[model samples]
Structures are given as C-alpha cells and as structure tokens.
Target chain A: MAKTPDSPLRVIGTSVTLSSEVQSRIRADLGFAIEFDVLDGSACLRRGVTRPDSFDIYDQWFHSVDVLHTAGSIMPIEVDRIDRWHQMAPMYRGAGLASGAPGRRQCVGRDPADVLFVQADNGLGREPTHQVSMLPTVCNADGFAYRRELAANRSGPESWGWLLEQNWGARCMLSQDPASSVTEVAMAARSAGLVEIADCTNLTIEEIDALFVLLNRRRKAGHFTRTWPTHEESVRLMAQPSTGLGSLWSPAYFELCASGVDLVYATPIEGYRGWHSGLCLSAALESAMCDRAYAYLNWWLSGAPGAILARQGYYMSVTEPLRDVLTPAEWAYWYEGKPATTPLPGPDGRISVNIGDRRAGGSYQDRMSAISFWSTIMEESNYLQRKWLEFVG
Target chain B: MVPSSERRSSSSRKTSDPIAERGGGYLYAMIHDLLQDKIASGALPVGATLKEGTIAAHVGTSRAPVRRALRNLAKSGLIRAADGQGYIVGKGAAVPLSSRQLYDTLNGGIGAVDRTVSAERIVQIVHGAIVAVMPFGHYRILESELGEHFGVSRTVAREVLWRLMEQSYIHKDRKSHWIVPQLSARDIRETLQMRRALEPQALRLVAHGLPSAFLTDLASRIDAVLADFQAVTAPRIDAIEHDICHNLFEDLQNKRMLASIRRNQIPLVVPRIFRRNFPLRDDLAALRLYDRILSALVSGDVDAAARLLEIHLDRAEALMLARLRVLSVLPPPRTDTWLSAIH
Candidate 1:
C-alpha cells in the first residue's frame, strides 16, 4: 500500500516547530509531506494528551516529557530505529550525570528515564533500554537582549540586573511565560542585589516574596514596557524604539538581526538559561503512520535540519552529521562564537550576520557550560503562574 | 537562622531520623538553640520581640515548639516578658554579662541539658511517627512501648494516645490497644472532597483581606518557582502550598473553618511519608495550575482565583491518589527505632 496526500502524517507543535527551510528540506530529502499544526504550548500539550489522534508526532521541549509520559499520551521509540542514536552529544547522552553543577542541569538530560531509551519491562535506566520517550533534536541557550545603542554608555559589565535598573525604566520587557520569565526575573533580582536566593531555580516563599516586592514596586513605577506572550511579540518589543532591553529567544534574535536591528544578545556575567527542543511520537499512531514518523525522525537526524537550525542559531543533538552540511566558516562562526569570516544568511535566507560579527558568549560549549539554570516547570509552578499573571497585570 | 555548624551538631546529637528532627521536640530544641545563639551574638537586638506565631511561621512549624522554645529562652535569662505582649531579648539576670559570657552560658549552661518530655511533646512526637508510618498499614501502638521509647511514664503516654484519638489518627480497640487506621481509597477521596469544598471558599473569603503588597510578593515568588519548575522539590512545593492554601487562609480568622481544613489535611500524610522514602516525583502540571490560581488572586480577581483553586485542587487530588496507589505497592518503609509498632 502507498501513502497519499490525503493521509499526510500529522505533526503538532508551536509555530516555529520546523522552519520553512527545514520543512522544505524534509519534503525534498525525505519525499514526504507533513501536515503541520502549530499551537501554543498549553494548547499543544492539551491536544497531544487528550486527543492523540489529532497528531502523529509532537515537536517540543523535553520539560513536558514527564507530563506526557504520565498521561500515557506518547509511546517510546526504539533506540535501534534512530540511526543516529550513538552520534548524540555525550553531554546529552549522559544527561546531567556529566554536569555536577548546582543549577546548570538541562531538564531533559537531568533524568535519563525521562528522555533516554528505556526497555518495556525495565524502567528509565542508564543503559540502553532499546526504547526512548523522545528523539533529541535542536537546542540552544537563551539570554537577554539589548539595543547596542542603549547599552553603549553603561559603565559595568553586562549583567541580568540591567533589566531591573532604574535607568532602563519603562524600557525593559520580560517574557510572559511563567517558567522562563520568573527564572529571568530571579536572575535579575539576584544580580541586582535586591534579594539573596539560595537557588535561583527553586526559590522559597520568602525569597519569592522579596523578589516580587521589588518587581511590584518597579512595575508600579513603570519600569517594565511590556510582557510578551509569544516569541514574535518578544521580537516586536525588542524592535520598538522605546524598548531598550528584554528577554529574547535565539531565533528571535536572529530574526531581529536579519531585519537590520542593531541589538546585542547579552551573555550576562550571571549565565545563560538553557533549553532543549525535541521530537516525541504520539501513542495513537497507527503502524503505518509510525513508520512514516520514524522516517521523519531519521530525516531530521540526517544533518539537513540540524544544519538549517544551526543557521538560525540552534545546536542539534548530533553535531557529527551537521558538520557535513555546514561549511567551515559557518561552523566556526556559530559554534566557536568567533567573528564570521563571511556574511551568513539567516533561516529565512536574509543576511543576518555580517563579516566580523561575533557572538557575545565565546563558543557553544562555554555558553552551555555556564548555564545558571534551565527553563523548567518548578514545583511551585501553580503559584508561579498566578504570580506571573499578577506581574503581567 | 542558626549557623549550619550548630544546626548540624544539635541535629546529630538529638536524633538520626530527619522526620523526628523536624517534629515538635527537636523543633523546640532547634528554635531554642537558634534564638539563644542569636541573642548571645547580639544578632537579636536587646529589645526585639519574639512572637511565637511569627517565629512558628518563619521556621515552617507549629506554635507548640516555638512557644516551648520561647519559654526556655525566658527561663535562661536571655529574654524577659515584654509587658503583656511576648518575650523580648534581654539580660534578665542581676549579673551584667558580656556577649562572650552570654554565648558561653547559652552553649554550656542551664538550657543545654535534655529536658523531660512533656505530654504535649509526646503527642507531637507520636503524631510525627504515625504520619511517617501510616502509609504502610495499621499498626498497634502499645502504651508501655510508647512510654519506654520516649522515656516517659505510662500516664504521659496515655495522654499522647488520647490526643491522637481526638485527632482521629488512632482509635482504641476492644482490648484497649490503640490502632492506627489503615488509609483507604475512600478516605483519600473524602479528604480531597472536603478540600475541594472548603479550600476554594477559604481562598474567596481571604482574598480581599490579604495585603496587596504580600499578595504581589507571593505572586512574584510563585513566578520564580514556575520559571524553573523542573528543578523544584517536594519541600518547596509544600512551602508554596502552605503559603497559598494554609498561610493565606489562616488570616480569615474563621476558627471552625480553619480547624476543619487542618483536620482534612489527612491525605497530606501520604505524600509526606512517600517523599521521605522515595526520590521526588515530578508534579509540574499541578505546579503550573497553582501558578495560574496565584495569578488570579494577585490580580484581585477573587472569583477567578476561587475557580482556579477548585480546578487546582481537583488536579492535585488526582495526582495525589495516583501517587498513593504507587506508594501502596512499594515495600513498607524502614521503621525508625524511635517509632516502635507493637504487635
């Protein structure tokens, strides 16, 4: 039996799930059309768990692995089926076992059972379980961004505290996502000397109170210009003449640069907030659809998507395959964080990085290693969401 | 806060079990030691008031231990009664003492010795032990074993048993043995049902009375937690829950409602026990939902907060029940020597 256009494999994720370049490459390289359904984070999770029939594959972050698995909404993929399984970075393979730092653990890699291949009878063990919850894909570290023009006159080093400075009053913006925003704010609060938090990742009620008091006072004083709910809004906010500094995702930063905005994504002295995005199979997929999904997953790992994502400022799980797809200049500029030898195109094929342009943080390894924390669903996330809503209001 | 070195020393000397160290007897000693150290070091100014309720909330414990700690502080001459209010930091003895002398006195003097366990302390100790073991199954508690374990008289042990009976944690059998009730699916469902009915109403009643500054601060704290939800621990979740569901509602001053809410917290014992024995399980969805409810409350949308609270409770109920089922299948936890389950 042959698959037809009427029965395209359904894939659900956020708008930026697959860039146009990657999607086109999938069609050209894998010879299959994917029906993409882009939904917001909450909506995506709801649809993925409640109506598994609605999508065959999910492209999202690893933080939701536990929630999805617990809901019985996703099936484990056999590691043997993922042709590039052994090629994954050791940092991801060993997960958090390699990193012993207090707050630098990537959520996905921190728990082997959550992401690694597990056997049907055996749980999420360290050794190969022959099955995995999700196939690792593109990942990147996130940091704040600022208009170079606004920060040109600042005296001190680039710090997260700059977001809370009185000078940037009504000029700074924060993401509206509770997990990301709260973590950013905490980093800012700690850097600014407004509060002393034991663990910026897991703030206590008292520490939270101290941080928010400053935030509320600043908010009432018109310190914040906007709270963006989406990455597009974040880019828009950063582009606004009045907005000087704000939280930014890597893709957005690339988009802004491509649009000729003179902004510098700050590799703050504090550290970057890292995150990893991956692919998950829906449990409801039929045997035929499952094969197509595996093919799609394999195609992503075949180097084209990784190379495309690298152009947009993301590092793929397996860098070996990506090396073949990218030129030496591209690799040096993106991964090494060195000055670009030649102008590089953004994912949209627009000139984003001019020759001699350098990444703020030196090297992907340096930035990833310096991660003070990762975007996570904290234990107190319910309270966090409520607080975030209040902060937004 | 007590210095980590002193806390370690005192904790090691007191009990090996972490749960016991968190309970009333150890809490009282820890608070007393910490306050004495603060007073001796002059970190607590000469006139600073030490209110039991404030101290209890700060240390994440009940007023029982704080009250006892305060009494001990007063007895040691580190603090004196401040009119009709509460204990105030002071040099109560006729002899003028230097900071070093006071420090020496606190470290090696009258308050350093082990005090006889009172009936109240016995009650707290037994309650903590019961909660630590309740998930395993029904256990018969012998008055003689309880007395011998705590080095208390049988009369004192009987008082503790009576207190447990009053709290509905244990009941006397026909043979006069106190039996802890086996936790059932129905009990969990009922407890959650009570929580659903009462907690939302409590949030609604207290939402208006809460200070905007405090609520804003609370919202910010919640935001911080949500920002890194994956790294969150069970204790952190317990603290946040205390702030939203217990601490905020306690301000309503509804004695009966507050008491009923406290009593219905029976299901919390399961999670507390399970977490002590197992690695922290991910509860991100509940935390995310809680974040939304806090957002509503902070925005002054009392109705929305109440509605969200209901949904949050429902989700929590389901998650907790599921966890309870998992816990039930695991082997019975190792019993601490201090916690004797007589046949």
Candidate 2:
C-alpha cells in the first residue's frame, strides 16, 4: 500500500503522532502508505513547525485553525471531493469561526466548511464530523447522573429540589469543564430555587467576597464538603454511595458506568451543554498526497476495521451505527430510557426520558451537535476549568 | 479582558516560576505524563490527603518546582483539597489504561444514567475515600487535603476555591493555579469584613422580598426557636438561634437577591478579614436584630422591616470591624505578601 515511488503523501498533525488512534485508523482502514509525522506541541507553538512544502496534510482542531490557516500552514481539501464526501448534520456546521470570518462554510451540515483560503489556494472537501481548524473529529455533551436509590428514596420535583438542597454544599461532583453543562446545572439549580451562581461574567470583588461569606457559612454548617474534586474523585463518588447526584460529560459518564457502577445519566429539564472541533490537512505537505488523504478520510468514515479501532480510542466516529454498537444495557441506560431514574429529556422540552432525539422526530443535527460541542468544549474548557478552580477550590 | 500581554506583570512576574517559563506548552506534557502515572498506578490514591510541604519534600524539590506538578495533578482529577486542610488524592487519580473506546464505553454508560449525587455528598465521599485510604492517626491528611479536593467545573469549583482562598485555606498564581492557603488572624479579619458586607445584604433582601410561604415557614421556625428557649432540656441555645437565622435567611426563594448582594461584597472584604473566636457579642446583636426584623415582617410593617434591616447590617459591620482591629495587631505573616488574587 505504499505510495507510488514517484509520489508520496505526507501528513503533519499537531498533538497526534503516527502512533495516535486516528493515524492507526487511517493506516488500518484506508491502507494508505505514507510518511506521517506528528509535530510536538512546542513545534506548533514555535511556528513553521513543519518544513515548507514538505507535506500534504495538516491536521488541527477547528478552534486552533485560525492561526495556522492564516499563516498558510495548510491547504483546504479539494472542491471535487466535497460533494463526494459523507454528509454531516447541520447543527455544528458553522460553529467557533471566530465570530465572523469569511470563507468558512458548512458542508453536509455535520462538518464545518474548512476555508481553503486560510492556508492554501485550493478548495477542500469538508467532513461534517466536526468543525476543524484542521481535521475532523466528533463532539461531546454534558449530562447528569443520579443514584437510583436516592431517586427512589424521594419523589416529585419538590424532592428533586430537596436533593440538591441537602447539606453537602459544593461537594457535589460536577465537572469544571466550563461547557454549558456547568452553567446548566447552576442555572437549573437557580431556576429551581436551589443554588446560586455568584455572577456569570464580570463578577466584582464584592460578589467574590460575598461568595466567600456564604461559603464560610455553608462550610461551617457543612453545606459544601470541599469545593472541587479531581475528575477521578468526582467519578468515584458518583458511583459510590456517597452523594446523590453528579453532573459530567457523556464520555466521562460512560467511563464510570463501564467500571460497573449502577449509576445512570439524566438529562435535566434544561438543554445539554455543547461544543465542536475538526481536522485539516497541512499546506506544508507535498501537493501529491491530497487524494490519498481524502481516500483515507473516506475509509475511516466507512465503518471499516481501522475506523472502528479509532472510535474505540474514545474519539466518537461518524462511521459506525450508534445504536447497534451500544449494548442493550448501555442502550437502555443511555440512549433508551433507564427505568431507574429520570428519563432522558427529549430535544422537545417535554419530560420524555427516551434518549433518541425527539426534535421534530429526527436525530441527525442533535447527534452532530453532540460531537462538535464535545470537541469545542474540551478545547475551550481550560479557562472555565481555571475559573471554576478559582471559584470553589 | 485585559490584553494578554498587558496582564503579564507584577503577579505574573512574582508568581511565575522557572518551570512556568517553559510555558503552558511544555508544562502540560510533563504534568500530563506525571498525572498519567499517578492516575494509572494509584500511587496518588483515591481520596488520599495531599500536602505542599510533603509533596515538596517527597519530590526533593522546593515549593515552586512542585507547584506546577500539583496544578497539573489537580487538573487531571488526581487531587483535591479539604476545606482548611490540604489536598487529597481523588478517585480520578486511578485512571485506567483503557483505550479511548473503552473510555467511550464507560463514559457513555456513566452519562446514560440518572445518578443524583449532591456536591456535599460528593465532598463527603471524597473525604471519606481519603479517610479510608489514610492509615491511623494521619490528621495531616484532613488538615491538608480537605480544602483542595473540589470537582472540576469552573464556576462551582471557583466558588469553593475562592472560599478556601478567603479563609486562607488555599492560594493561587496569576493564572489561578491553586495551592493550599495558609491561615492567620489577618486573613480571618478580612474574611469577616467580607461577611459583614454580604451577609447583612443577603439578610436585607431576604427581608424585602420576604415571600409569603417563606414567612409562614419563618413563623414556624420562630415558634420552634421560642419552643427551644422554653424547653428545659434544650441542648444548645445557639443551635436554635443558628437554625432560626439560617432557615429564615437561607430560603432558596430569596437566593437571587441575596446572592447578588453577597457576590458584590464578599471578595472586597474577605482578603483583609480574619476569623476569631465566634463573636458572641456580634452573634447576639445579629440574633436580636433578626428577631426584630422577623417581627416587623410578620407584623406587616414594611417600615420596621426597613429600619431593622439597616440596624442589622450596621451592627454586623461594626462588630466585624472591632474583631478585625484586634487581629490587625497580631504578629501575622507579611500581610502585603498575600495578594487579593486569592480568588
């Protein structure tokens, strides 16, 4: 499967190496024979991380694409390939584009249109998996988990409010990821008249001080145990018989349940917190490898063995059938309704616990947003996380 | 948003270490690797206690070298802090060597169910988990780790961290990376001033928009207080006062207004305030003022409600300041060394 001796395909990825999950998927499924080098983190930061005119593909996240694209680090996918490419959902098609940059477009609704002009003068095929500054990837969403026994222990919205009203204080295990999930939880709690967020933006010194006073009161009364916990502790306590509820991302929640806990994920009455990201080819690569990169992408999304392997690496895939892949227990607990807790809320504001999207009776855009939001969240989560640490640590 | 370049002085200068000079780029990898090891091997242990001095000593390095390491640890879910204590190893410390697919499987499963765990219970669980991990007589774990062990969500976590900071339980750099905060009378005084500003304001609002249901609830609560005062076998007078005051003021219905007031006042005062012996004098005055306010509200005298509100707030401020004055005289750590960036 090596490239013809006369022509070679080269790829330079930021943060991903030849040994990475995505690369292995490409190697295994697409069977592309090419030289792939992963630029170190510092290399990307130092600028000109790759040799000029050395490679054909430059893979990066959608959020980070701005600088690279502007610097002509990579070229867009060829135009002819866009129509032939697998279609993406419409929800995340144009997310995180620096508010108003021209040339960014949506293709197949699932992927962000990678602006060809950002890096090179070539049109590029857009994969709808996620909006990429460089390459394609799935997204993530924030979800809730609850103790079966606790929900059974109480009933109705009043009890639900009472549950959060319990004395543990900020000891609740929620991610500081800063995606909508955190705000959703706080907002929902506030809406239910249970908890309060000091201020969303521009919290003054006085507000911060007031939070401290309330925190001290709660601390003295043991309202919040300690503000923050490690993701691991958050996971463990969620599974254990400790607290009654937790808030986290779908992937993280999945990890906990796979560890053999009886916990279940719940969608609050509120909407899921969301974000998206993507993959792109580098401009510095040799011009000859563009087609092969497309072929590799197609093969990866075709649900072939390599793609399956890559999906297993924790990154969501656009290839596989989500329903068939999930176990019956998993399906019922996650996608289907888990009988033990609040049923997953439908995209409709109704209280249906059914996991599939009930929005106008289709699930495509919902699924795309689910993936795009995940990636965007992770990339943007750093600041929210820091802020959260400052708020409660 | 201060320009990133402009924001890079003073705190950034003094707070940054040689390791940080390597930048968030280099540090992330090293920290990630270190955390990967800690989470994988359970060397960090779920719910185990953490200490700056101990971590510094065990790693054979100074506090600066270990600061980035601890921040990285905290980021990865390997560690947290106990309130007024130190960091504790978190359950996430034991990250499994699963493929991302396995993680997906697990994460999907965890995400699917409706587990209703509260923040307090989560904290207790982590605290208990650490306690379980500790051997007999390791009080240092409780003292060192409780304040640092908070969940990862930025908003809520920041709240807890700020509290730890206000109480001199934890500290952070300009980028807001965290460390266990040291406590002193000075810190306590500043915290009191913060309490003075916010607490009374919260009380005032709770008075203004005194919901009908909350008022009924307060009536019963006051009756309970009167009952407690009358009961010959009453356990603690302060308990009744605490309950009456807490239930009357902590109503969720009034949270927005109260939170609004408190949010504006706490940070401005907390860094300068210090904690002292529970100020019985202030507490008594607060109790009497609350009683009068409750009476006025129950009597439907909006004017009395307004008057008592001002009195309550004024007394709280005066009492808190009196305490702060005494603490200011203590031979505390260099007060200027503690920046307002504790949040």
Tens digits of lDDT, candidate 1, A244-316: 8888888889999999898888888877777767788987777777778999899878988888888878887
Residue-level lDDT of model 2, residues B288-309, one tens digit each, is: 5666776778777766766676
lDDT of 2 at A272: 37
Q: Assess the local accuracy of residue A115 in candidate 1 as a C-alpha lDDT between 0 and 100.
A: 47
lDDT of each: 0.70, 0.40
Native contacts matched by each model: 0.00, 0.02
Compose the digit string of candidate 2's lDDT tens values, residues A1-393.
Answer: 333534656666543223344466566655557667665432432233224355555544343444344334555554246432344333224433222223322211112343312322222223333223443454433445665555664445322233245543234454433333344444444445644544222223333344345434544654443422234456555655555665644433544554555555554333333333344665544435556766654553454322232222223335344445544433444333243243332112233333442221013233323321222222112223333455455
Candidate 2 iRMSD, 1 decimal = 23.1
Give lDDT for model 1: 0.70
